[model samples]
Target: MRRRLIIVLCLAVVLVVAARLVMVTRDLPAQLTGAHFEGLRPEPNRLRAFLHRMPKGGDLHTHLSGAVYAERLIAWAIADGLCLDPAAMVILSPPANAPAERPCGDEAKVVPIADAVAGWRGQTTYDLLVDALSMRWFLPTPAVPSGHDQFFSTFSKFNPATGGSDWQRTLARTAEMTVDQLRQYQAENVQYAEFMVTLLEGEDRRRLGEAIGSEREPKAMLAALEQSGITAVVTQKVEELRALVARVDEMRGCAADRTRPGCGVQFRYIAQVNRNGAPAEVFAQTAVAAALARAAPSIVAGLNYVGPEDYRAARQDYRTHMRWIGFLAADVPVALHAGELWLGLVPPPDLDFHIRDAIETASARRIGHGTAIGFERDMDGLLAEMKRRGVAVEIALTSSDVILGVRGRNHPIRTYLSAGVDVTLATDDAGVSRIDLTNEYVRAARDHGLGYGRLKRFAFAALEKSFLPAADKQQQEQKLQRAFAAFEQEVTDDLAWPDWLAAFARALLPRRG
Candidate 1:
């Protein structure tokens, strides 16, 4: 009798599981039909939800400072005991002398940290600061002229809030900011990000430049730059980078078998050389980046040229900077910011050669912006080279619209695609631009009429063209492919069944019991 009872119980367990599996399988066909029907729309709400659920391969063009939103920056500032100059919308390390000007109200000459805190305590004051610090609540006002100026100018306003380049705090702050960004990416289903992180600036940068001196030859310059004690400077920054990577990994539980959302995603840093600086400074910065790449290959993989592309120094020494990059790129990789200008934004001559030079001279593996590709001399030839070399262009659709006022047909996305060049979408400054990776896809689909298949290819290209090593890139690609298959299964085979199927399963299952 005991043996019979155990047999019956085991049979009962098997029967229940079998019944559940049958019910799940019976409903799959109807579920797939519904999904097929819903997949036809290219409009907003539906498409946004679709892309949001889709796996984005990576975000290859995000900036660290511009990735953290304003509200968080303010919170960080307050926590750091930093005061706000509400009048100028700048965060300052407490007033040194006092009584320069009032923060919010004109009544007080100087606003104490306590006063600043109290002022921002109100929702309205906080919102005002958010608007000033980012593109949030942005409107064309007499005081603020163009959206382009407003977009770029936010960096200056929040520079003090980021605590500047004070070595003791810079790494910790950057790591925390990157962690926040990783959370955002995970929420959006993005699996990777390459941050354009600037780890050195101010006196440290100046000191490094002095050490490197003024050698113009690539070989000799690199040799001199190496022996100039610049490695000590780079070593200090590399230590910071290691600490940052370690903190992020810990927060994400990277070493554990089951990691959090943050750890599920991988992050790599690309050191950005400040293009607005002088030639020697640019060389020094490049050398430092090369060293970082050598010392911290796990975290730092590439170098970039970052700044206002239309700035005088960047335009004047454009080729020279590319030469510096080309020299370093023999041992490292680069993704340069080129052709960010528009027709009227800079001289026509500036627009004609940037994209060409970055590719031909710098041998940049990737091009960020590439907005002015249409204006390049021998545009056809350039497109062919891009295709031949498999150089991917990182398009930030939202920022392009805000800064260059280029969207829809005015944007060169179709040109790149039609020319057979590899293209991927990125969030140039998600926090500042108030947009995310999904927004880029949505814009690409809605405006450019990109189908689901075309969009998925963009995601694939992101990882394929990334700076990750061969084995890592292959592994990431496989992971992405798996994610896509699972997504398809969830939407097509596991969706809610039709009413008739659910009713049929319910009625049939009970009768079987």
Candidate 2:
């Protein structure tokens, strides 16, 4: 009877000890991570390394064309035998009547891209090309006087390489770009991405717009688009996108090894409708985007209106565009690039309505670069609506800082969070901005004084607020949770035993006999 009593007491003690250990283990990693974050605050490189390995759930605002580095674009241009305008730093197709060997003709100013990047002077030109193709070493100049101008101008400069006239080559380029971005995201520990790409371009898009003609009414326009065989086009495009993903898988060797970096990173597209285009063209693009999103929710996650929000056409027809989206994409998810504007970038009135209209009219699930939220007409009500609807705001720190000069306290990230609105970090144009997702997290920490817990919430919020289907999103969230567990445990292990603790433990041990 005494032995049984002792056994019961021992078992109770074990249970109590185990419970204590479990509680300690549950909170230990977070405590250690917070300490590590604070310790590494002064060390930018160490902080970046810490954040780089941390799992970022998703990059929901990336642009496929802008996500690629300039060096890769240059390589593609060389491979395609394209020309370079030295002074302009822009890629151009071969002159029509030029010989195959002399694609740029005998014009001294226009040299083959390969030739332009060769030798000593070529090295200098290559540097300039990289700068011209991105925001690297950018400063206000006579020709490109504003960061906004320099930022938007890069598309035209690199258009020849990315959007060539050859359909097959363009598709190949798109595939290559997708693979490149996937690899990049994997490297930065981004588990998922929703790349904004123009899937319906070239002849099909133009024809659809031409068919839409003067059909201003949404029902009539959608019917016109349907009668114009847009369904067939969407079908073909979906298959083409599937093939593109297959190509990406092949490129990443994902079929052979599921554990490959790019293989583990899942992605989907957000079809981009260029707001700078004519009204009919924009309407046609929006219609096709809506249809595509509905037809392939798994592949095409959603639709977003891209291009400069402050452009005359975009501003003038902003409300009309929202109305059109409201009608066409009633059931489809929308993530409009609203409120990317700033005070001087546009008139004050323009800022007041873009974000409001995006949510109230277009029913945007997310807002990309919502930098102008503070300038909206009903700021409090807008925040309330965003919070109530659970509409997330995608914040691209580097993009906002460089393009709109909005960063630090000027940024609306804190405001969004304070209002209970979901906020996620993204790389708007990582390549163009010369930043990765880690860079954004680092900025959030260093610039905004966010701790590890807040940053982790951002990571989780990215996946939670994504346009992914319920199952996919849940899977991604589970993956993110696993990643965080591993990451935190690793951090705890690294930080749990300091030099003093090790020394003390060694001192406490008995000497060898």
Candidate 3:
């Protein structure tokens, strides 16, 4: 009889609390389902909702080489008939079946195409590594130096067949493949707020330096490509870029239901020019970026070259590259992939200047990675400048979490945040690094000991800090403001909170109950 009375008393209390919640909210969906989490470990569902509605902006610091996984690249290679050597672990050109010379790479690290495919089917470590390529956005460091090298070197293997592989056919095929993967990801809870694309292009210095028509050396090749028509080639590239960006945008924003409105996602472009390119090449590429920025609306951004960190040839051209960017960016808005260095991979001087030159000269409104900021001199002063200029720094949380631990509470991220330097989270090479923004967010919150408020603020910063235009960014800010107001009011107004929060706290400590 006593046990039955206790159960009835509990039921009555639950009903009274439910009634109180209805009275307070008037009629609204309960956001914080903390009541649902009765056990010791906190409820992550409420946390997930909080993150979902957090109004996170787009990811600005993304890379193409590391963005696409090696497995996908190898898959593309195998589809083209290229095979990987088991012992050497490098992808062969023209595939094994039937073709001419194509670029191959260092034998030691990467396996051949056929061996990889077989190993991949049997779930060998090679297959595991290849499978890991697409997952780079989420996973912890996968042999950082080796992975980085493998990622960059795989380019040579893909470049050759890419030309002979019926360029149009290959592009369309890749588009389909990209769409299919995004769909699969959606089914599995991968959320994308926005995507920015950077296409890689190499420039011809000697020819561009001489002038548009002066093909004095490598005359045969120059004659063939010129006959192929520069305007036509540029158009083709632009069209291909448009299609690819369209596909990515569509994929990222694809909804489960046609009738339902979904998240805000926009697509932007950046024309990447390598920092290590020859002056002539760099100048020409910059001109192309300016032109594209002028020509396309869906594409309103410019960038150039990606992996200068690996190019031993351009060690002395940092200032020259900055100057070239200045000339090119006189007509367009750009973001530079700057300061992504460490003590070992880049020389000391490079760590000092790459971040400095990008800001002082290149007119780069945004900087990707900027990991070496801790290593740069006068960093505090730089942070002040960044705060004053409102030049936001995009931090690759997925990548950084793997490498950076607490350099103290005032590590690079916290220092930037505390100093009022706008900091954003990014996934530099999601596919290769095997990580996504969500995982980055989770890790950042846990590792950095960040509160919900701080994480949401960072999400807000990431979007507004994007190199997107003033009008679009302003619109996004307003939308974010509305969302922020709602969240802020919820936290501040305890009465407005779900009755469970108040009831639970009250129950735990009541006055003369």
Candidate 4:
């Protein structure tokens, strides 16, 4: 009799919750639903603001160097006492009157920020550097001319500012960058970010390469590499990364106040392999990434392979690279950038296998880009398998449009969604692409027909598929659920409707005579 009463009480509580949810949902603007999402086409600003306030659980795909805006990068360059090449706008170490590459001719000067501060031309030069360092300069009347080339080229222009050879300086720069980025993301209500951070240097690369030299057998190679004292090197770097993460957390006041802006964000790093490097170079970096992740799982959560997929080295060694990752899959989490190519960008055959190899071979839990999944062999089967395996695809809608002219109907977002494969929207290179996580959500809603609920699911999936440990994941999930509930109730409380938007919503509903 007691058990029956308990069951009856539980059923009544569920009914009450269900009824309350229906009432709350009814108070929300009808346009927030999948059916009415397309109607937001005309109110771009309004939709952007709405999504900005939406709780984005995490950004699973982002590059640290590519996340910071060019303007801030320029300021950092100036403060670092770096000089700028006026013609190419490249930042480098300096002497003001140093000879520069031609095109600016013999008169070209590498102006120091201190020197520039005293003159208007220096300030003008600073303004111009911002454009040269990012897509901000591209006057896209139609589209950016050679955007693919331009996008990749931006990295080289800012590389000198990152303090090469000095991993400590790199860590400092990264810590500083994270604070800035975390503030921005938190303003958009993002709770977490997993930055693709590179931790290798020339010496470590050479050491690891020589140790694992020309070993054909995977087991032998793994054994030889392990015996090579590479773990000692990785340990040092892992300590550096941990220190950096701690410094960044302190800057965000994470240790003092969890509720502070940017403090609430849980940031982690992923060691990135430069996919365009030579076979030895690639494998060595992979070894370091795998080892480092295992050594410092808290600070360095996983590993990723990053580079243009169409590059000759990355293209030819694609399978070889996947196998390398496969060898370490048991130890490291893989998030490979595969199928970032499009038609005419590479031979059609190239697109067919990149994502599949990443999935079937590397066992990547998350696939970044996966843009060309439609062109893969047996597309339907692949989609089914992805769904079965629970491999989520990180979709960067804005970056896709900027790089491949693929967006809206041309994008496979709907295809993935319909296939029951989990899809999470991200800002791949918000700095380079001139976008934000909020804007990506807005684009997905406006262009790809994702409603508020679908957007929420994507946000949740980001945290769910993250490299965070099980316990931390559960804690974050609980916090995120609470945040979402609070946000929904706030929205439901008054609808927060402005007079114009309320009228707009009413117009979409049936009229009463």
Candidate topping TM-score: 2
lDDT of 4 by residue, 286-363 (tens): 888988888888988999999888899998889998998998755688888988988989988798999899999999
Better of 1 and 3 by TM-score: 1
Stretches > 4 Å off in candidate 3 = 1-55, 69-80, 93-121, 125-170, 173-236, 239-264, 308-314, 401-411, 475-499, 502-513
Instruction: Indicate which candidate wins on lDDT.
Output: 2
Alpha carbon lDDT of each predicted model: 0.80, 0.87, 0.56, 0.80
Worst 10 residues of 1 by lDDT: 504-513
TM-score winner between 1 and 2, please give it. 2
Q: Which stretches of candidate 2 lie over 4 Å from their true place?
A: 1-25, 499-513
Output the better candidate (1/2) by lDDT. Answer: 2
Cα-based TM-score, every candidate: 0.85, 0.91, 0.69, 0.87
Ordering by TM-score: 2, 4, 1, 3
Model 1 stretches with alpha carbons more than 4 Å out: 1-43, 95-114, 117-121, 212-220, 494-513
lDDT for 259 in candidate 2 is 81
Candidate 3 lDDT, tens digit per residue, 1-513? 999999999999998877765544552322232221121115555555445444455566665444555656666766666655554344555323332343234434444455455643645645644644433333335553444455555445444333333455545544544454444334323323333333324333344443543332333323444554544545656787787767655655555444222323444556666556555454555555666676664564666446645367455766666776776565676677777666777668778777777887876777777777877789888878888878777777656434432233434777777788777777766765666556566656555656554666676786676656789778777766666566545644544445556434543321220
